[model samples]
Target: MKPALFYLIFFGILSGLLGCKKDHVENVPPGQDWTYDPTPFEIKAPASFPILNIPVGNPTTVEGVKLGRMLYYDPVLHSDSLRACASCHSQERSFTSDPPVLPHVNLAWNTSFLWNGKVEGALEDIMLFEVKEFFKTDLEKLQNHQDYPKLFYEAFGARTITHELCAKALSQFQRTLISGKSKYDRVLEGTNWVFLTDEELNGFDIFFTEKGDCFHCHGGILFTDNSFHNNALDASPEPARSAITSNPADVGKFKSPTLRNIELTGPYMHDGRYETLEEVVDFYSEGLKTSETVDPLMKSLHLGGKHLTTQEKSDLIAFLKSLTDTAFIADTALASPFH
Candidate 1:
């Protein structure tokens, strides 16, 4: 061959390779941008609750949140293909199951997932460790199949699921699960779609008053202290905080949950004992079972015997209903992606 022709052919191939590289670079999606819209509703956090501290490494991003949402609703993470995180933490009930009905008798409707509020860690931790363990599958199988390892690389800059990346993605997705725009929120925002009846207003007053004493633990936009407390619900004299910390006094304590959608997220309390809010109120009013580690806050209120007038009880329920955010429940963004 002529030297000039051979040189031209080599250079042509090199140019083609360079052009292909450029196209590949162009086609790749950019890293996620972390900013999210925070204006729809002011979180209205109570003075007692601190600003929720999110981790620094996994900044909130649209892409990361989307990926987390996909993972959240995907049952692929489960071993037998039976459960997704959503199976227990259902979106319809504020990311909690209403109540599981077993064979012979109906189980009390408690909040979802692990019994002891042990799943309070980052969502990624729950998904990777807790969930994967539940399925009892091998780690390699999880990493190799389903393109999950590739997804981890894309969402987070890692090829494998590190605890930090998983937590970041899960937390980012959770932060997006905001439950604003309830009837109570509307009333707070001065909307006229529905007016609070006088009785409900009275119930609201009672809820905030010393007589009810409910506000101490359940005050704030999220309606939780965000601190662990022992409500003395356990049958055995077990120390709650001991599990999280070996401190003797810490036993029997559990984290308080948000009351945003309380009516739907029943039967009430840590153990799911109360079927009705009325039962819950009555317990607080009178059923203060004494225990060595009982919360100092749980003093006899002389409430149940006095009896909330039927109208007052109804009003209190109405106020609780006001906490339910219908818009959140039906949000397409949070729905199961598999469907």
Candidate 2:
């Protein structure tokens, strides 16, 4: 069925399920009705996935995830109702902005948020910034929305519509965005998966070896060491990590995003300059910018790039595409619940 039709039907059934009569919790709040579901919010991930670093105060809950899913797709978060967090961070692109902007995959493991590591409080801090600073959401409208206030009440009983609730619910839903069904994952687990082509194998070797030297930062199940570095985007100073720290030594340093879905998350780099995977690979292969903060992994400052052959670059690109998780992007649970 078409996704829109499916979404409408699915949510129709969900609304019926949510309509079941239940004993309302006895909240002492004068005029507030409080209800909290005990449904466990199990994060679907492989057994090999690392332990989730969820904040103690904000454990995942069913109502929270439902509210968050709505908030994510709700254009009501923006004053003009023309954009949403999902307007930029779309599920089709693995919760990343369409610009090949840094994605929002596997963020429970991330210690910081955004392409720049400046925001250090919590993942909710990102929502606080996106709604308040970046997009300027009309909270009054959100509170007065047909369903948002009700959903917020369901998620956080007695708490009126606030940015904090928005962030918390959004964070709950985001933490559930686990992408471990890629071919790379299956192959690594020694499953009876499709065998890698020799070109892809060679590319993998190149990626891990000193020749490609990509593993240091982009390695493991998450595909990121989750650190800030100047990957030599340009020689001129760019407002990067330093914009947060104001440390001159941190100039041009930006957080290294995961390469899990690298195939689709282009144009590559902090500025979204490169348009294609070929351009990105070719840049790392021959167009490394010499910068004071350039990552030491780039190696041999005089040599602009990794200097991979054309065929090697092609193979590398193939290996990178292997990381794409078609199932993750198509997950109905992650789709817009409002549709």
Candidate 3:
């Protein structure tokens, strides 16, 4: 062969092998980096409740959060046009609906979120599911709408409402709904401006004491363990865990919600059985109905007998009120973008 041709052919063969080697290297799995930008809103998050793990595709951004806020308040997502995400998870109420009802008992309980606690999924997933449940519609159906496809294209670089974008937008918006600047937090941070009266101090003692024993499940900054437990409120011993795991031992278990804004997120419990803080204290104090699945932590609390003196109860309530962050409920950044 000619020297030039021979060199060309040799180099070409070597290049082919190098190309194959490069392709093989590329095929190897790369390490997964799940980090994303944290929510921009300011709040007093516990170290335990570390920045929520946002999915890789849907990162937190001011524009994306704005789009999510718009979607959250849009009534068109509902079948009846009467409800929006904000309708059920109102900002004023710490994103939970109040005044829960029991069908068989004709009883009204201070409810949190939907009638049942079944809606306690991830904020993004819940938003997507609500839309689907309302109209039996998915992103495909949404794409056929007059302006939805266009909106999606603008928000997510696509003309279709994929589950990824739906979840991302909603999650970004919900993350902005943090509420941490309460009077209680100020007291904890050693701000003398929030002066707790003697009654309030007494109530605080009771809350952490053996008589109240509320700290077991409601401990930590969020005031919830973020785990599920059965407090023995089952009427028929139905298996609650069957829905998720089909395990008999998991029956009647429910997630513990945060008590940051408990005053607004009332009719407490998974069923919204208690209406007031006093009623809730009384339940722990004197009204614990026993069952096989009762949480081991829930010993019968005397609440220092008589469910605390009236003054003590009032003080406890005052402490709970200190947990409410008025600034969070009125944050313009979280409000409907349309407004």
Best by lDDT: 2
lDDT of each: 0.61, 0.81, 0.61
- Candidate 1 per-residue lDDT over residues 205-230, each given as its tens digit: 87777656567777756676556667
Q: Give me the runs in candidate 2 sitting further than 4 Å from their true place.
A: 1-34
Cα deviation at 84, candidate 1, in Å, is 1.2
Q: CA shift at 35, candidate 2, in angstroms? A: 3.0
Pick out the ten consecutive residues of candidate 2 with the lowest summed lDDT. Answer: 21-30
Candidate 2 matches the true fold with a TM-score of 0.87
**Best candidate, TM-score-wise?**
2
Instruction: In model 2, state the lDDT of residue 193.
Output: 51
All candidates' TM-scores? 0.74, 0.87, 0.72
Better of 2 and 3 by lDDT: 2
After superposition, the stretches of candidate 1 with alpha carbons farther than 4 Å from their true spots are: 1-52, 98-139, 146-150, 232-238, 301-307
By descending lDDT, how would the candidates be arranged? 2, 3, 1
- Model 3 Cα lDDT, one tens digit per residue, 1-339: 899999999999999999988887786423122223344533234343445555555666755676677777877666566677777667667666755321110001112223224555455555556556654434554666665565555556554476667657766666666666777777777777676667767767767776566678777676766566776564454565446656666677776666677777788876676888878866655566656676777766222233566676777677677777888778786676674
**Model 3 stretches with alpha carbons more than 4 Å out:** 1-51, 99-128, 133-135, 138-151, 234-238, 301-309
lDDT for position 113 in model 3: 27
